[model samples]
Target: MSRLKLPHNPKLLSHWEGWENATVYSTEGNSVLVQTVDMITPILDDPYDFGQVVAANAISDIYTMGCLPELALNIIAFPCSVLPKVVLSQILAGGQDKAEEAGVLIGGGHTVEDDELKYGMVVTGFGTKDNLWRVGGAKNGDVLILTKPIGTGIISTALKAGEATLETINIVAESMKKLNNLPVLLKNHKIKINACTDVTGFGLMVHALSLINKSKLGIKIVAREIPIFKKANELALSGFVPGGAYRNQEWASPRVIINATPAKMPFDPILLFDPQTSGGLLVAVEEKNAELLLNILKEAGFSATSIIGSLVVDKEERIEII
Candidate 1:
C-alpha cells in the first residue's frame, strides 16, 4: 500500500533501515533531522487524557532517536455531528499542551468527519551526530534499561472490563501521559546511549529483540528484574490480557528462549509481551555507565526505571528470559 520510493543519498541514514522508530536524515553539518508519525483511537475515558496520551505516544519515536522535538502537525478525525464541538476542542487543547510541554511548535493540522474519533501528530526533531542513537547498535555487554514500568495493556483492558479501581486508572493514566525525555536528560548529563527504542504496541520483548536484529547478539532478561504494575499481574491472571499480548508472544516465541517460569505471580513473565501504549524507552548503555544512567533517571523522578538485562553473544537465540 505504500508508494514510498526510497531515494539514494549519502545523508539519508535511515533510508533502508527497517523497523526503526523514526526516519533520520543526517546533515552536512554533522546534525540529523528525525521524522515520525503515530496515531491511536480513544484509550482513556476522558477525551483530554486520550489526546495527551496520543501526543506523547507520537512524539516518543523522536525522543527514542535522541532528538529534541521541534515541530508537529495535528492529524484528527472526529464525529463532528455526533460529539459536541467542545470535545473536539478539548482534544486539540490537550494535544497542544502536551506538545508545548515538549517544546514543540504545532504549526497546523487537518481534520475530517468520521463516525469515530482519532488523533495523532507528525513530529520532527533535531539532534547532533554524536548524540543520535539507533535501534541496531547495541553492543555485547551493554546493559538494557527500561525507563518505565510495564503493563499498560493489561491495566487498560481491566479498566474497560470494569475491574480496574480508581487507583489503577490514575496510575496507568499518569504513566501513559508522561513523556520519554530520557534521551535529552542523558545527553545533558553527558551519558552515552549505545542503542534505544520506545516500548509500544509490539511490547518489551519484541522491541528488545529489534535491537539485536541481523546480529550475533542476544538479550538476557532477568525475569524478576523486569518491572510490572502489581494490579496488572492480578488482572492478567484473571484473564484480562489483551489480544496484542498474545500476538506478540506468538511472534517472538520462535526466536525467544524462556528459561524461567511465570513464578508465584503466574502472570508476571507474560507482561514482557503485553503491549504498552505510551511506554518507556528500552535503552542500551555501556556496562560501566548503566548504574549512573539508572540513578540519573531515578533522580529525575523516574522511580520505576530498572536495569532489566544485558546484551550477550549468543548466536543461537535472539532473546532469553531467565
Candidate 2:
C-alpha cells in the first residue's frame, strides 16, 4: 500500500504517517479529524458479546488519539443462511449499545453475506491539534502508564481449545468489552500526555516500540510490574498461546532487550508479546505527574492501571525489559 503512487495531501499530519490511525486536518483547520477502520473475527461464542468487543476494539483507535468518537458505520459479514435472523439482530443490537455507551451514533451500516462471521466499525472523531496524541511524542524520563491488563490473546486461544474455564472466559470477555475512555478522565486533570497508543494485535512490546521510533530514546519496562490476567500465563505455558503471539515475539525480539530473567516463571516472555483485543491505552507523561495521573485513573475505576515503564536515552535499543 505504501508503494502505490498516490497524490499527496499536505493537510495530513506527517507525524502520524505510519501510525495505525490517520489524522487529517479539516478544511477550516480549526479542528483535526481522526478516522480509523477496524474489524475482527469472532473471538467469543455469543454473537452479542462478540459485537460488543468488536465495537470497543474499533473505537479504541480514536480514543488512543485523545479524541471522542462521534460517528460510526458498522461493517459486518455473516452467514445468514446458516444462522438465524435473531443472531444477526442480536449482534447488531450489541454493537449499537456499545457505540451508544461511547456517546457515538450508529447512524447506518453495511452488511455482506459470507461463510465466516466478522464484525467491526469505521469510526470518526474530532479533536484540536494541541490536544491530539500520537505515537511519537515521548520524551526522556517520561513515565509510561498502562490502563489495563494484558493476556487477552492467550485467554482467547485457550477458549478455542476448550481449556479455559467459564469464569476465565467471562473475565476476558468483560475486559475486551470495556471501553478505554481514559481520555475523558485525563481531560479533567489537565495532565500533559506526551504520547499515547492502544495496545492491540501488535502486543505491548511492539506498540511501545512504536512510541520511541527514531526519537533517540528507549523504553525500560519493569516486567514484574506488568499486569496479566489470572490464568493467562498458565494457559500460555500450556501451549494455549495464539499464533499472533509468536509473530509479535518474532517482530519485537531484536528490538527488545530483557535485562533480568524471571525465576521459575513459565511463559513470562509471552506476556510482553501477547496480542490483545480491546486493550488499554499506554500513555507517556512526565515523571513528576505520573502518580497524579495514575491516581486519577484509579479514582475513575481503572484499578488495573499501572506505571509499568519509562523512557530513557538509550541509543542501542528501543526497549529494555527488566
CA deviation > 4 Å runs, candidate 1: 1-7, 264-268
Could you tell me every candidate's TM-score relative to the true structure?
A: 0.95, 0.95
RMSD list, candidates in order: 1.8, 1.7
User: In model 2, which residue pairs have backbone atoms overlapping below 3 Å?
Assistant: none
Q: Which candidate is the best by TM-score?
A: 2
Clashes of each: 0, 0
The local distance difference test score of model 1 is 0.88
**lDDT value, residue 60 of candidate 1:** 96
Please, what are the lDDT tens digits per residue for candidate 2 over residues 1-322?
7786654787766333575454555545668888888998889988899889999999999888888899999998989899998988989898999999999999899999999888989998888888888788999999999988999999999998999999999988888898988777777677888999999999999999989887889998888778788999889889988889899999999999888666623347978899999998899999999999989888877788899999999886479887
Model 2, 221: alpha-carbon shift in Å?
Answer: 0.6
- Relative to the true structure, how large is the alpha-carbon lDDT of every model? 0.88, 0.86
